[model samples]
Target: MNRSAEMADLSGTIEVARVVLVIGLVFLHYFAYPNSRVPPFEGFDPNHHQVATFVNSFVLFFFFSAVPLLSTISGWLFFGFSARPWEAIRRRIGKRGWSLFVPLVIWNLGALAIAFALRAVAPTSSLLGPFGIDFAHFGLWDGVDAVLGLTRLPVAFQFWFVRDLFVTVLASPLLWLMLRHAPLLAAAALCVAWLADFTFFGLFIRTDVLFFFYLGALARLRGVEPRVGWNTTKLLLLVYVVLMALRALAPLAFDPSQPDQREMLDLFTRLARPLGVVACWGLCLRLAATAWGEVIGRYGGFAFFLHAAHFPLIIFVKFVLWRLVPAETDAWMIAHYAAS
Candidate 1:
C-alpha cells in the first residue's frame, strides 16, 4: 500500500485506540491493589482475599500501558505525513494552548482547589494525609509546587504523564532532525535510555515518554503501520502476559515494597510495557470489530477531560464510598470500580 493509505489507516486505528486507552486509564486508577497502608487504598490478607489478589494482579497488568500508547499516538499525530514539527508545536503552544502545559496547570490547579476544600472539611481525616492535603505547615512553596509541578508532581500526580509529555513535545523539533538524519540510531539510543530507567531532574520525568513519542515519529518517518502479523501479535501478547504474571506473583516470594524487590518489579514493568503497547493494538482491533469499540469511540474527544478529571473525582468518590459502605467485599469493590 501507498504511504498516504498507510497514514490514513493508522490514523483511524489511533482514533479507536485513544478512546480505548482512556477507558483503560480509568480502569487502572479506580481498580487497583488495596494497600491498607495507604488510606484511600485497601489491603487484602492473601490467606483470605485470594480473589481480590488475583483481580488486582490481572487488571493492573492488563491496563498498565495506557500512557505510553497515548504518548505514541500524540507523537505520530504531531509529525503527520510531511513531518512538520515546528507547525505542530506552534499549534499546540501558539494558541492559548490545548493539550500540553496549559492543561497541565489548569487541571492541577483545579485538583489543588478541591484538596483545599477537603482539608477544610476534614483536617484530621487520614484520607487527607495520603493526598498531601493534611494542610500541615502548608506554605507558599508547597502551594507553588502543587500548582506548577515545579519540583515534584502536582497534587493530582497523574498529570505527571502530561508533564513528561510536554517536555518531549517541546523537544520534538530537535528530535525530528535527529530522526531524519539517523532514525534507527536515534530511536535505539532513546530506547536504551528508556529501558535503563534513565532519568534527569530538569526534564523528561519518564524516559518512556521520550521513547514512545519518538517511536511514533519513527513509525511515520518509515511509513510503518501500528500493527503486526497475527503471529507476532500472539508472541507479544504471550510475553506481556508472562511478564505481568511474574509481577503479580512476585509478592509471594519477596516484599514488593522493599528497595531490592521494588527494583526487580520496576525492571519487570519496563520490560513488559512495550510488549503491552503492541498487545493493546491487537486488543484495539478486536474491540473495534465489536459494539464495545463503537461505544468507546464515541468518547474519543473526551480523553483529555477524563484524564484530567479522574484523579480528585476518584479520591472523593472512593473516600465517600468507603465511609458509607464500611465493607471491603468483592461485590463492593466491583461496585466502587463501576461507580467511579
Candidate 2:
C-alpha cells in the first residue's frame, strides 16, 4: 500500500481500538474498582452493604464512561501534555533535566508555598483543618504537586505516573544507543525489566515503560509499517484476554488457607500487569491501523488526564448536588447533571 493509504488505515484502526478501550476501562472501573463507586464506610469496619454496593455499581457504569469522553475532548483542546510545565522544561533542559541542584531548589519552593497556602485557608474546612494547608489536601494545589512530582520527585499518587514518565524520558538517550546496535536484544531486555517491575520495583523503574514507546519510535525510524492480518489481531486479542483472566485468577490461586501460595500468586500478578499492559497496547495499536484509528488515538491520548481529573469532578458534583437536592432522588442523577 502507498504511504497515505497506510497512514489512513492505521488511523482508522487506532480510533476503533481507542473507543473499545475507553468502554472497557469504564467497565473495569465500575464493576472491578469497588472502592471508587461504592459508598465510603458508613461504619467503623467499612463493611460493604449488599444493596448499596449493587446500586453503586449500576450507577458507576454510566458515570465512568462519561468522564473519559469529556476528559478526552478537554485534553485535545488544551494541547495534549502542554498543560505540563515540566514537559516544557524538559524540552528546554534536555538531558540535564535530572540535575538535582537547580530543579530541586525550584520544586521545594513550590511545595512550601502550597503547604503554607493549604494551612492558611484550611481551618474553614473540616478536612483541611487537621492536615495544615498543603498540596496533599487542596484541590487546586494537587495539580501543581503532580507537575513538580513529574520532575522525578515523589509527592503523591498522581506523581507516580509523572515520575515514571520522567524516568522513561531520562533513559531515552541510552535506549536510543542500544536500539541502534541491538534491537532484538533491547526488546528482550525491556520485556524482562517490565516483568521485574511488576513483581519487585516501584513505578520509578521506568526502563520497562520507556521500552515500549522507544520500540514504537524505532519501528518508525526503521520504516517498519507492520501489516498485521486479522488472524494476528485475533491471536493478540485472545492472548490479551487470557492474560487478563490469569491476572484476575492470580490473586485467587491461593486458598485463604495457604499464605505461601497467596504470596506467590500476588508476585505473579505483579509481573502480569506490565505484560498485560503490553498485550493490550499491542492489540490497540493493531486495531488502530484500521479505519477507526484516528478516533481511538485522539481519545487514548487523553486517558491519563481524564482518569485523574474526572474522579474529583465527579466527587465534587455529587457532593454539591447531594447537599442541594433531597436524598430521595438519585445521587448519580445529580452527579450527572453537575458533570454535564
lDDT of candidates 1 onward, in order? 0.71, 0.43
Tens digits of lDDT, candidate 1, 169-201: 778778878887988998888888887778665
Q: Which residue pairs in candidate 1 have backbone atoms (N, alpha carbon, C) closer than 3 angstroms, thus clashing? A: 34-42
Question: How well does model 2 score by local distance difference test?
Answer: 0.43
- Candidate 2 lDDT over 280-315, as tens digits, reads 445656656555565566676565444333332333
- Best model number under lDDT: 1
Model 2: how far is 62 from its true place, Å?
A: 19
At residue 322, candidate 1 shows an lDDT of 66
Could you give the C-alpha RMSD of every candidate to the true structure, in order shown? 3.2, 9.4
lDDT value, residue 88 of candidate 2: 45
Worst 10 residues of 2 by lDDT: 38-47
What lDDT score goes with residue 149 in model 2?
50
